[model samples]
Target: MRLSCLQENLSKGLAIVGRAAASRSTLPITSNVLVATDEGRLKLSATNLEIAVSCWIGAKIEEEGATTVPAKLLTEFIGSLPNDKIEMALSAKKILTMKCARFEARMTGVDARDFPPIPRVENGVAVKVDVAEFKKGVARVVFAAATDESRPVLTGIDALFEGSVLTLAAADGFRLAVYKMPLAEAASQKVKAIIPAKTLSEVSRLLSDGDESIGITVDTQKSQILFKLKNVELVSQLLQGAFPQYSQIIPQSHTTRAVVETPAFLMAARTAQIFARDGGGIVRLIMTPGGGKTPGRLSITARSEEIGEDQAELDAAVSGEEAKIAFNGKYLLDVLGVISEGQVALEVTGPSSPGVIRPVGTDNYVHVVMPMFVQW
Candidate 1:
């Protein structure tokens, strides 16, 4: 391809697809980024077989061609160049020549035909979702997905699209997070998809690139899902398996409920995490009800045999009798950190039962976390 584009746009386009390129793949071509001319614009694409990302940038095309070049080398080189026009030309022998601001380089790359073609989900149902709403729900749900590959289904986020609402849920055996969001436009059909949590995490990052709305397409025939933005798109292979019934995992009722400030509770958990790290990552919580004169309080404490102990107390709006529970410090912090509300409500039936956490002002998000079994 013979084209000229601004250094700023080239650098940003490379950064967008760099993460999808395979770092260590058996197929050598997977490590290369496909640079091609598409509909009068320069298209950059990268894929690791499981996921693919592509972005288009405006360019002045002199000649139409395509080439596959080393993704890391090209990304770093373009990023270091000055903000000037970059001229790129590909030879018949697959050598890519580039010059920008007096710098010159010739790199040998594979032919574009050798690179795997990006998938196109033809005849797939299209759904429009508000980018801001999707990002918030994804951020809260993806953290609960299991990182281990032993249970493949648990590593994916269960997405249900029905009517004008989209529900996302994830669980990792220890904690579960569920979020329901309203779509920008009503979908024509109902669908259920299990998308990889890793891909959703990347999607969440891409939403911050200033896209007001995102287009979603589910291709069951190809077992893939596509996310398209104004100038970028990502396609991912869906995980094939049945997700557990998450509704049954959430506690139906609670004997004790405590409402406290989200920030204060988060800070207490953060400080406890430092001490809990060496002590099985356990943080103990104690909630006490107030009588006629005394104020209700929730006390957090963590102890380690080698290190010291941490204790913090926050006033809460507690009801029911006193309750005690213990949880992994990181898990507690993960849920509390994502909560945007001013206050959060915690429901505990008993120390052995699961603890239910919900944002005080919103009914769209809820979390159920299993308490760590420990000596009281």
Candidate 2:
């Protein structure tokens, strides 16, 4: 393949697809990126079996061909080149020659045919959603996914469609995050798919901050899904088992409730975590009400035998009855950081039952945290 493209465009395309390159794969082709020149454009592709990404850039194509080159080396080299046009050509022996200004380098490459073929989304139902909305939904739930591979189903975020609403949910047994948003084009179709957290994270990064729209195609037969942006496409394999029925765990009612400033609560929890253990950081919350009309006092405490103890208090609007609960400080902070609202409502059933945290004036999203048992 021979193509001449601007340095900026080439660098951007490489960075986009380079994210999928396998870092520790047994196959040599998985570590390399496929570069193909066709129809006056240069296409770059990378795959790690589970996920694949492809991007196209406008180029001046002199010869139509394809080859696989080292993804990281090519990306770093192109990024270091001067702000001039770059010329890339492949010889008969699959040697890639890159030249920009006076700098020139040659690297041996493998045949493009050796690279695994990405799944083709030929006939599948396509759904369109706003990029910003999709990214926001992902941010609210992706962090709650379990990283342990022992239960593969728990490592994926469940995307369910019903009517015009799309709900994304993730739970790691300790904490659960659920976010729901309305789809622009409502299809009466229902789709339930478990998408890997790693794949969703990459898709979230690919989405720009603008108001552009994205197309999602689901292939049920092949057990694959495709996300298409302006000039890039991401294909991911869906996780196979049945996700647990998480709704049964959410409490239908609460006996105690408190409304507090989101930022204040987050700050207190983060500071209290200093005294918590490394693996399972625990924090205790004590809610005290003064009178019928007076606001309540929220106190946070954390203690570790090896470390020290911490305590902080903040005034909050409390109702129902007084309650004390213990939880993982890091989990509380993670849920609080994603909320865009100023106030947050904490609903508690008891010390043993899970606590639900919801942003004020929003019923579409709910964060649930399982209480931690403190021996002291």
Candidate 3:
């Protein structure tokens, strides 16, 4: 294979697909990125069996062939080269020769035939979504996915499409996040599937690179989902299982509700985390109702045997009865960190029941966190 391409375009493609390449796997070929000539363009692809990413770069293809090279080495080498055009040629022995302004290197690679075939989106149901809205929906829920893969379904985000609405949900047992958005084009058929959080996270990043609408294809027959953004496409295997029934867990009504500033609440929780770390990462929220002329206030506190205590009070608009609840500091902070700037509403049924959180004046997203059992 012989081709010449711009340094910036090639570098960006490598960086985007490199994340899907396996570093150390039983199959050595999975560590390599397949470079090929496709209809006057250079196609770069990488896969770890679960997810596959392909990016095409504009290139001058002198010869038609393909080869697989170490993803890390090629990515680093291409990124270090100058902004000039890069010429690459592969010999019969599968050695890749790369040259730019003053740099020259030869790297041995494996034949492209040994690489796994990436799934393609052919005649599948496609839907269009607003890039900014889709990204925001993904951010609001992806972090809540389970990091520990004990429950495979929980490690992914549950994507449910019905008519013109799309709902994305993620949960780690301790907390659950759900975001809803309207799709630009209504899907012809309803579908539900669990997609790996890692894949969704990468797709979210790719959306920012372009201002165009994103195209999503769900091929349920092949159990593969495809996300198309500009010249890049991501294909991932759908996790086969039913996500937990999360709607029943969310409290219908709260005994107490507190509306507090997002930044102030986040800052107080972060400061308290310093002390909460030593004591099961516990952060307590105490809400009180206002009387005739007094304003309601929410008291945030954390304490530990080794570390001192931290306490702060923020004025809040409280409704219903007064209540105090204990929660894992990290869990609370995680939800607060991703919330868009504005006031947030906290709803609690009791000290032991789960607490619900949602941004004020917006019904698009909601988070439910299970309260910790603590003696107070």
* Candidate number achieving the greatest lDDT relative to the actual structure: 1
lDDT of 2 by residue, 1-376 (tens): 7889999999999999998999999987899999997577999999999999999999999999999999999999999999999999999998999999999999899999899997888656678888888988999999999999999999999988767888899999888888998887664578888999999999999887663888888777898999998889999999999988989878899988888898998888888887776536989998776586777988889887776789998898877788989998888889989984599989997889999999998798999999998764
lDDT of each: 0.93, 0.88, 0.92
Please count the clashing residue pairs in each candidate, in the order shown.
0, 0, 0
Worst 10 residues of 3 by lDDT: 205-214
Clashing pairs in 2: none
Task: Rank by TM-score, highest first.
Answer: 1, 3, 2
Q: Per-residue lDDT tens digits of candidate 1, residues 231-264?
A: 9999999999999999999999998999999999
Query: Which whole-number lDDT from 0 to 100 does residue 368 have in model 2?
Result: 93
Residue ranges of candidate 1 with Cα displaced over 4 Å: none
| Total backbone clashes of candidate 3, pairs 3 or more residues apart or in separate chains | 0
Please tell me which predicted candidate would have the highest TM-score against the true structure.
1
TM-score of 1: 0.98
Cα error, residue 139 of model 1, in Å, equals: 0.8
